[model samples]
Target: MNLTLKIWRQKDANAKGGIVTYQLGGVEPDMSFLEMLDVLNQDLIDKGEEPVVFDHDCREGICGTCSLQINGEPHGPDRLITTCQLHMRMFKDGDTIVIEPFRAKAFPVIKDLIVDRSSFERIQQAGGYVSVNTSGNTQDANAILVPKDKADTAFDAATCIGCGACVAACKNASAMLFTSAKVSQLALLPQGEVEADRRVLAMVEQMDKEGFGNCTNTGACEIECPKGISLENIARMNREYLRASTK
Candidate 1:
């Protein structure tokens, strides 16, 4: 298949950027999106042209580093899919694909398709962890014996990969989904109980300090999230924040 790619190119965060066009020929329908990009970059390199730059790691979709806004949709038109997992077959021949980096003031564009998502790391550093002693191995997996329901919920919340798709897809660029997912995962587990209040407050404050926008319940973030992270997590975080604030 052939495709016309209109990709955003910027030298740096402060540099002026614009869409640069390139025509990709002979893209295999089954090729993963990043593989197609590799083909494109190879062609550009052969001609001594600067290759298109994009983020990718563990292309199987676990890393969440392959960030791209394709055809005006975060991670393309697919639901519950990362950019690396996106297949070229989703597009038809002669399609014009508009590619851009994940857009959010907090996530400044570094180059072609890469954005600095270290804001997430900073938020995590703020208090997204527990304080369990690890001097020795625990007794057994069944020792804690949390309710199955809570365990399941916590597992679901833990699936968040910090892709920043939630912020990019939000009208206000809210980091609520990402922050809440981290909170919910630990808050639901028995091990995360001791510092729950402090954790919520610290993470939320860090999120705000990162310049991320507020959540208005537009639900765009959940939809664009490659992991299907739910807005229910946002609601949970809100309740946690409210309770912490009152306390």
Candidate 2:
């Protein structure tokens, strides 16, 4: 199919960005959005022009690295999928697609469609892991019998890929949903109990320090999240934080 792509181009975080338009043809409907971008880049290279820069890894959607704002929506118009998982078939022939990077104060633009999401990594490093060591005296996971429902919820929360879509989707660019999901993933499991209080406090504090906005309960974060991370995780985190603050 023939199309027009209006993509953002910037030299770096300090560079002024604007939309640059290019026309292309023969985009297969089955091609993922990144593949379509690849075609466009190849065209640019063939013309001795610089290619657009975007972040992507494991295009299968597990890595959550291929993030783009398509037509004002994070990861395009598709639901429950990352930018790399979006297919070209979602568009029509002769369409004009607008693509930009996820915009947030914490996620400053690097170049073109790439943004520095290392803020997420910093937040994770703050308190997103279980500190327990099981190398030498490990007990079988099955020995600590977890309730099925709690286990399911924790697993659901763990699916968060830290894509920062939650922040991009929020009007205020809040990272509460992402931060809460990290907290809930640990809060529900007995293995994470030891660090529960400290984990929530540290993660939340770091999230704020990174310049992420507050959650006003708009719920856009969950709606745009590729993993469908629930608002309940935010609620659970609030409860956890309250309890932690008391201690």
Candidate 3:
């Protein structure tokens, strides 16, 4: 298939950026979106031009590193898939595709189609880990009993991949869905019960300091999330925060 791509190109964080157009032919329907981009880059390199830079790793959709805003959608027009998992067949022959990096004040552009999502790592580092050590004092899994339902919910919340799709989808650039998922995952578990209150408070405080906006409950984040992380996690986080504050 022949296609036209309008991609945003930036040399660095301070460089002036703009949409640059390119035309390509022979885009196979079976090619993954990143594979198609690879073809484009090869062509550019062959022409003595710099290849387009985009983030990608573990293209199987686990790492959540391949993030691109395709035609105004977080991970293209797909329901629950990262940019690397997106296929060329999602577009028709002769389609004009606009590919851009995820945009948020906290996500600064690094180069063509690559944005610095280290903000997420910072927020995670703030309070996303369990405080307990399990080196030699690890307990048997069967020693503690956890309700099936609560365990299921906690597992669901733990599916978040920190892809920044939530922030890109939100009109407010809110990290609430991602941050709240991390909070809820631990808050719902017995092992996490020890520092639950402090965890929520610190994570939320760090999220705010990252310059992320407030969640307006537009529900865009859950809709675009590749893992299908629920909006319910946000509600759970709010409840946890309230309980923490009251204590």
**lDDT values for all models:** 0.92, 0.93, 0.92
> Model 3 over residues 1-247: C-alpha lDDT tens digits?
9999999998888999999999999899999999999999999999999999999999999998989999999999999899999999899999999999999989989998998999888888888888756699977767778999999999999988999999999999999999999998888888889988888899899889989999999999999999999999999999999999999
Q: Per-prediction TM-score, please?
A: 0.97, 0.97, 0.98
lDDT per residue as tens, model 1, 98-215: 9999899899988878899999999999999988666796556578889989999999999999999898888898999999999999999988889999999999999999999999
Q: Candidates ranked by lDDT, best first?
A: 2, 3, 1
> Per model, how many backbone clashes are there?
0, 0, 0
Q: Which 10 consecutive positions of candidate 2 have the poorest summed lDDT?
A: 131-140
TM-score of 2: 0.97
- In angstroms, how far off is 29's CA in candidate 2? 1.4
User: For residue 175, what is the lDDT in candidate 3?
Assistant: 97
Question: Which stretches in model 1 have alpha-carbon errors above 4 Å?
Answer: 137-141
Candidate 2 yields a Cα-based lDDT of 0.93
Better of 1 and 3 by TM-score: 3
lDDT (tens digit, per residue) of candidate 2 on 1-247? 9999999999888999899999999999999999999999998999999999999999988988888989998999999999999999999999999988999999999898999999898888999998756689877778888999999999999999988899989999999999999999989999999898999999999999999998999988999999999999999999999999998
lDDT (0-100) at residue 217 of candidate 3?
Answer: 98
